[model samples]
Target: MDGTPLILTSAERTRAARLLARFTDSYENSLTRRPIAPDEDRETLAKLLAEPFPEEGLGVDAFFADVVDRIVPYTTTIAHPRFLAYVQGPPNGIGPYAEAIAAVLNQNCNLWQISPAANVIERSIMDWLTGLFRLGPHSGGLLTSGGSGATKDAITAAIADRRTDFRERGLQENHAPLVLYTSDEAHRSVVKAAALLGIGLHNVRTIPTDDRFQLRVDLLMHAIAEDRAAGKEPFCVVATAGTVTTGSIDPIGPIADLCAKEDLWLHVDGAYGALFILADSARDALLPLSRADSITLDPHKLLYAPLEAGALLVKDMAKLRAAFAFSSTSSYLTAIDDAHLLDYMDHGPQLSRSFKALKVWAALRTFGVGAFRTVTERCLSLAARLGEHIADAPGLELMNPVTLTAVCLHMPGRNAEAHAELLTRLHEEGTAMLGPARVHEQACVRACVTNHRTTEADIDLLAERLIALAKR
Candidate 1:
């Protein structure tokens, strides 16, 4: 009773741990039966939103009860087996435990001296990822908040690589406007990154895609030449390994060749598709990823790590340091010279970084690499199976090639509104949660097999429901 409320007694800590274990067990068991979308009670939610914080503290038991009764029922069950919507899914089994451990330790991973173990763990994770891409001896990277942050940082480095005086003169003082090229199918992150980094939207060329939704390398070459003729400095080309809408992979090999010929920095956005390299079926298509100057990856997607874990891998470590490292005049943050250890603060934009790498490291270590490979291969197979079912079904058309784990389908007679209606019905009826997408201006339904919990039965059930809906 003498201790502050913030510090719980040993007996209270034991009780809290027991409660957490029980809640986790119950939730995991209920995931399959739970509705994919929440049935929101608007009145209750509005009241909760307007509620003010009390001066008196609620006991841990009452707080736990509130979470179980109020919060849990109103949250979307992304872990549902049939919850096939976007490039997100439930975290791996080890993720939550690792997250809890990281939270308890609360280590600031900015500098090696401050958190030696965390620094080493992050370095190890980066080394493993770089090895996956076969990035050379000089290659290294750092964890980011997500794919967007990684892509933004990659573009920043690309600018530094192209403009020697960029650090001093900045974009406003530059003579020629630097340009970036990416396929129309590339994630919006590329364009967003350009806009954020002072590269105007006009400077970012959206190259057309081929019949298969892959980037047309011929058009890309032509665009680069046209920019050069127009007195614009073409500096970077972003290639997509996994597109968001259809999971179409851009032609990386030819794009790499083009980049090499033009001396342009190549950054591959592999946030969704790159990790599919672990699958034998996808290895050949993504083998050319090693040729990229920099690559962005999201461990949360395929690696089954918890949210907010992304990374940027660069072939030359010195370039990444050059892009971000700033000499701080603060006496408290003296640079340490340890060859084996890295000060993460000098490698990225953030100085106060969290232990985001811990969950990723734990997942890889606990489940082993082969487990992830198996899950990825399974997802690919599931997508292909779903595509086949859609093609064979009456009135259903396969909109895009099942290149990876995203299957795009369309009803012959239905428009965008019909597809939207079907998606809404599926969620409301608890059949399955699918997303609506556009393929070449035609509306389609998209199911991404990013969840490891999903099975063949889940796919068949979803397909059956969709076919019934379309027929009606």
Candidate 2:
């Protein structure tokens, strides 16, 4: 291979662009007809696995051909309109172009001097998100890898806020065991964060929820008091805005009040449902989120952005800075003293970050906020329709109230294994793709209508197929 082959010439660039355009157009057009899950060909897959990396490049044309023939056929079509399995969906139209731009620029967004334009764009995006939640003037945040990362960062800040010497002494030096509180319905990321921070599973309280699946505020208070009596320090409470299983939103208002009374840091995990605030119907329910000390959001979920875009917002930017910022004495990263710009390295763990904010910014700017709001509202409507259909169906039961875009359904005589099998059958049959869930110890099927492309016809088809399958 020659050195000239490494960089694409103008003609090569144009050819590659044409190839990408063709692929995207075909992919989008075939989404509805494609199977939700691929039938794995073990023999072909083995061959692919055994293939070794070549010393010479295959070139763009051959590489694109391989992607189309080998890779695309064996992938789940999550972008399908009927793919209602999880809280994920296809990327918006502008996402790919913005991603390409970001990749070409290869901006390292850790410092202002290194990525001045990217830094400004990220700050602007964060500002818009914080403004949506009414997080106040001093509020600020940084983009993260995903909701898990954002939650972990928020918990770290909470730890620092509660224990000033956490940086030096770590969790071992604390006089008393620090306990973290979250509802049982909360996402597993909360528990994961607690464990990763060395708080230990024993010190993490999983308070029970009420019949509606909302966190029981009374039980939470009791748990906190009990922990305090045992000489354990209760420092932070993690609440859920939109849970994963049934889309149950914990009572943020009551949780915030309790956190204030107990002098505990309140962090709302809104990764699945926070962006629904853009919908007018969800605003009232999520309004109390502003009272939280910190919040975690995923733009990839509701915003229709591409994968791996998550964020953490703090009411007071100083708390986040205190948690992650290091005063490096190194001459290389000499801090730039500019109030208008920020050093992203001070906000999170990664010293080398990508321009993940560009895709999000581009989508928002391209389609405008109103377009997203309409799609979000439509998703909620579709979920509600599914819940209604489930309730009226002969053998199906509505597991939880359709609070957002997730609807859980139960077949009367189905066990957990049976529900799993039914989900497999649905995927195989290509009627639709749904997930399995346990609702109050009973097996159920979960359909999350987060896909913007989903329509009423698709919902009807899913309902009809599910009813027919249940009768079998």
Candidate 3:
């Protein structure tokens, strides 16, 4: 053969297709088919990977075999129905195919000229989300990596919108130290974002939460007044729609009122709970989201899209543009955009963007909003059931209210370390994978029913295991 680069020919394509089909089949059967206890790799994967890379390709067949033989077994099965850990669950049925299609197209979603349909699709998705929250006509947003990025974008926009001369002088300018506030129950992203933005940890105040784990509005108001009196610029207040540990919702309405009076930017970290607004009850609970200047939400968590699907929505879109659209950059390789098109580069920090909107749009269209609502509602109900079971059990105590989809339970007589041990035991037993959370300074095993695939039986199995563990 000549020194020409080895490309996948017809035979290689057929082999690849067959290998992919096999992989998909294995994944589909993973739910009912459990891996062997003390699972062992019949082949040594380390040795295979440790070999030096060959300048000449091994061709497609050997590559596919290596992937199937070595890589597949060692991977944790997140798609498995029983694998419930952190705020992550299972991906929706259409998500995998949509993601594959996106990869195949490889559309750079930076501008409409490069990806016209993608730009429109993202805009449509954002419009739908904004309408869902009842955020009026001027509402717009940018798709982000995940909830962390979304929250960071929200905070950035808030800062940009509030500063009187931020356009001319960045945060580098010496001014009264800017302070931001969030409930103790808010996600750590708020504190991290503030720190990353040059707001010292000392400037980020963690307001106390009430018995329900919601932020105390009175305390927040007092903090604002104190900051004002101290000659500090209190710029933003981050309210949580769903906290990580307890799934507690902050008092957004009262918080918004304070922001309005104090002229503070209001950003809601709704990464976990905002999509629950698909449900009538959840929507009713989140009425205050519309009042916020900006909000962060994760489609990956609630919409059941594949990983890395988050969004930051602002009531006024210009604030987002003002924050990020400074670097006037042009590329000869990229097409020029018309006034009719949306240049997504102006929306967020990234100039090269992936077609993330495809999976989201595909899921929404395939399952429809009604299906998402039903799934979200089911997750909430399942959490409630699990919480009830934990409450009624002899040795277990519910750590917090199961407001959204998180059920935090602890063995009352034990410490955090013991709870952690129990969590390990459950995972080892193949019952489920539950995350450990510290709620109100107590160690608790946390199970978040965020998957559309989670069922009553799954909740029952989790509760049964907990009850058995507690009794022991």
Across 60-99, the per-residue lDDT of candidate 3 in tens digits comes to 7788777776766676767666666778767888898899
Model 1, range 263-349, lDDT digits (tens) per residue? Answer: 999999999999999999999999899999999999999998888899999999899889889898998999788999998888889
Per-residue error for 428 in candidate 2, Å, reads 0.9
lDDT of each: 0.92, 0.92, 0.85
Please report the TM-score between candidate 1 and the true structure: 0.98
Where model 1 places Cα greater than 4 Å from the true spot, the runs are 1-3
Local accuracy of candidate 2 as per-residue lDDT tens digits, 6-81: 6988888999999999999999898888888875999988999999999988888998899899998898898899
**Global Cα lDDT for candidate 1:** 0.92
Rank candidates, lDDT, best first: 2, 1, 3
Candidate 1 vs candidate 3: which has greater lDDT? 1
What's each prediction's TM-score?
0.98, 0.98, 0.94
Summed over model 2, clashes come to 0
